[model samples]
Target: MQLTSTIQKLHERAPRLGKALSLATATGVITGNSIGASIPIWFMGAAKTITGAKIADDTVIKVTNYWINSNNALIDNILPNKDWRINLPDDVHSKGKYLLISNHQSWVDTSIVQYVSEKRLPLTRFFTKFELIYIPVIGQAFYFLDFPMMRRHSKEAVAKNPALQGKDIEEAKRACALLKSKPFTLLNYLEGTRFTKAKHTKQQSPYSHLLKPRAGGLALAINALGEDIDGILDMTIVYPDG
Candidate 1:
């Protein structure tokens, strides 16, 4: 671990070092996640993009999943609590195609999904915005993983331009069609974004801890994938200390 020496030194020199140790570990995790993993993943993804073979794309997906697993392992190492209790179905098959739906909270939700579904679901990919391709590293990685990149058209815009009415769904279908060749899990956050107190109040959400669920995104997924989707996995997550 990169922070091990520094944390030990801080513990030796500082009277109150608990927070310092935690901070160092957190820093290390961030550095390792971004640098130790994402940089290489970016280049590998670029290589995957250049190739025209399905086998190459599958290989890239496997690598990305391994990257997620590595990050999950590191996070577990950094956390003080080792026991995470979540009820996942016993029938969830590793080789089956799945649509995983969950509530979004903090940025940590991605990692939580990766950790919980690691061995249970086929390495999960999330539906991303089409504009995310403009981002540097993460965009490239997501593209390499072949996650469906949705191009959303506003209702008003679609009404004004009749030609664009079903364009978004067609693009989604094209983007998601790649998953048909392999068994994979795609995660969709039903709320469409992270949950927040302001958003909840504004939406007048019915759920106690969740924002109002947006059916449009799920509809897009269903329309795009048709009957290719194997099954659904619904999850509820909570952070007690929040």
Candidate 2:
């Protein structure tokens, strides 16, 4: 609380320095938390793979929950106050399975999802590119946590090599299957990419605010986990400043 007040006061006094300090503080905290949580996750992930141990699987998720809670704490205590209006169904539970679809606008959208979902929903996982595995702790943590990883093929590449066609879909299905046994909140950005005016212009989007949603990913998720999912959730986020 004192730190938050100090930072806010500093911002009022010198905006640039305060902004820099805020970024530095957030980056350091998140980085340290990720690294610390990832070590146990990696070892437990390996154990789960090797032994098919439920304890290992549970431990990984427990650690991940702690990691998220730490970040949520940072948001509550360290960041500036704002009018954060979050509405979730009363029936939603941490042990329920759900498919969450949302508009893609900026990187902060994912963080917002985390913020709203801390204890109200099951652990949130999203589709990630397979190439992200090469990135350090966070990427590997995604794999450990069973976040679906996709290998998307461009139309041109698929056209040139017909063998590549449908491979990504098959891989995505396999990834989704990994979550069938556990409670989860799977997030899919229906827009497929971040929304931009240039992209909106190029696509000649019909909607005033959103890009034309690509339904294939949602279809794939349903085909893979339809029976287990409790509900399909649609979340709309509005940024007043944007």
Candidate 3:
């Protein structure tokens, strides 16, 4: 708490330096936590793969929850004061199975999701590109946690190689199947990509603020986990500063 107060006071006295210090602190903490967690995740992930051990999977999720909790603590204690209003149905719980749909805006949106969902909902996982598995700590953690990794093929590529057609959907379904046995909040960004003026203008979006919604991912999730999902929830994030 003292550290938080000191940082806030610094912000009041020197805005730029405080902001820089805050960013550096956040980056260091998150990176350190992720690296520390990933070591165990990698070993357990390998064990799970080799032995099909449920305990290994559970261990990875526990580590991930701790990692997220650490980041959430940073948001609560280290950041400047601001209004962060989150509204959810009373029925939502950490043990519930849910499909969360949200808009895509910025990279920070995922962190916001983590912040809002700390104790209110189950650990959240989103669709990730399969190529991300090659990245260090964070990517490996995502893989071990069973985040649905999709390999999207462009239309041109699919057209040239007909065998690639429908492959992505099949891979996505296989990934989604991994979550059926567990409590999860699967997030789908209906906009497919982050919204930008240039892209929105190019698409001639119908809405004043949002881009066109892609139903494919949501439909895929429904097809794969429809029977297991407790509810489909919609979330809209507004950035007052933007």
lDDT of each: 0.77, 0.90, 0.90
How would you order the candidates by TM-score, starting with the best? 3, 2, 1
Q: For model 2, how does the per-residue alpha-carbon lDDT over 1-242 read when each residue is reduced to its tens digit? A: 78878987888888899878888888899999998998999999989978989999999999999999999888776566467878888999999999999998999999999889998999999989999999988788888888889898999999999999999889989989999999899999999999999999999999988999899888999999978999999999999888
Candidate 3 lDDT for residue 167? 94
Residue pairs with clashing backbones, model 2: none
123 in model 3: Cα distance from truth in Å?
A: 1.1
Off by over 4 Å in 2: 154-163
lDDT of 2: 0.90
- Which digits, one per residue and each the tens of the lDDT, describe model 3 over residues 112-168? 998888999999999989999999887877887889998989999989999999998
**Model 1, span 21-135: residue lDDT tens:** 6767677766666665566666666666677666666666666777778777666654443468888777887789888888999998888888888887888888888899888
- Taking all chains together, the TM-score of candidate 1 against the true structure is 0.82
lDDT of 2 at 24: 89
lDDT for predicted candidate 3 compared with the true structure: 0.90
Q: By summed lDDT, which 10 consecutive residues of candidate 1 come out lowest?
A: 74-83
